[model samples]
Target: MEKKLERIINNYLYEDIKEIQKSENLRNLGLDSMSSIELLISIETEFDIQIPDSYLVPGTFENFEKLKETIESILLP
Candidate 1:
């Protein structure tokens, strides 16, 4: 599941970037509000996890990894 999420993010982010570890800045990699929303939706579809609206705040790719973690905890729990 982690690999899947990493793959999805890597598809959009540059390859040079390290795998997301809950601390990387996705925004610097070119993520935006719409992209974030789209990514969020993709995660839900792929993992069947319902992400909270709170995780979507302040739209930034940098926040993406954390969002993934948040969703993962919910789905895996």
Candidate 2:
């Protein structure tokens, strides 16, 4: 799942996961409103899970690690 997430981020945002800081902000990664929406859609499609509005807030998508954690929480028991 982590690898898939990284690939989606890399493909959509055009940043290499190996080069990205875990704490780097998504906005700093060049994510605008459009890309952010596309990223959310990609996440749901990749993981085959529906993300609730509660997880769509700014803090949840703050960085790569946070986004991974958010999806992890949703997918894992």
Candidate 3:
């Protein structure tokens, strides 16, 4: 799951996936509002899950771990 998530994020980032730390801020890595939306769509499609509106926030996409946690919570819970 983490690897898939990394691949998804790598699509929008300029930096190499190997250089992106789980705690690193995605926005700083090139995730803007536009790319974020595309990223959300990609994730939903890839995971075949609808993210709740409550989870749609800047903080959810703040870093890799946060995004993974959000998806895991929705999928697991």
Candidate 4:
């Protein structure tokens, strides 16, 4: 799941991922509102899940791990 999430993020992020980690904040990775929206759309399309706007807060997308966890929670439960 982490790897897949990483791939999705990589498709949108322009930064070099050599030193990137799951714990790193996505905003720190240069994810502005535009890229964030793209990511949300990509996640929905890839996972076939609808993430409610209530879960679209900054904390949910704070990092790769957090985003992965949030998505898993929605999909698994």
C-alpha lDDT values of all predictions: 0.66, 0.84, 0.93, 0.83
Q: How would you order the candidates by lDDT, starting with the best?
A: 3, 2, 4, 1
> lDDT by residue for model 1 over 1-77, one digit each (tens)?
75687767765665434544456678777666677778778877888777766656664345555656576668777
lDDT of 4 by residue, 1-77 (tens): 66677778887666644357778888888888889999999999988999988999989878888888889999899
Please give, for residues 1-77, the per-residue lDDT of candidate 2 as tens digits.
87888889886565786697878888887888788889999999989999999878888778889999899898995
Candidate 4 TM-score versus the reference: 0.88
**lDDT, residue 5, model 2:** 86
Q: What is candidate 3's lDDT per residue for 1-77, written digit by digit as tens?
A: 98899999999998966685779999999999999999999999999999999999999999999999999998999
Global CA lDDT computed for model 3: 0.93
Highest TM-score, which number?
Answer: 3
lDDT for residue 18 in candidate 2, whole number 0-100: 67
Candidate topping lDDT: 3
Segments of candidate 2 deviating more than 4 angstroms: none
Model 4, residue pairs in steric clash? none
Provide the lDDT at 11 for model 1: 58
**Model 3 residue 24 lDDT score:** 90
Worst 10 residues of 2 by lDDT: 11-20
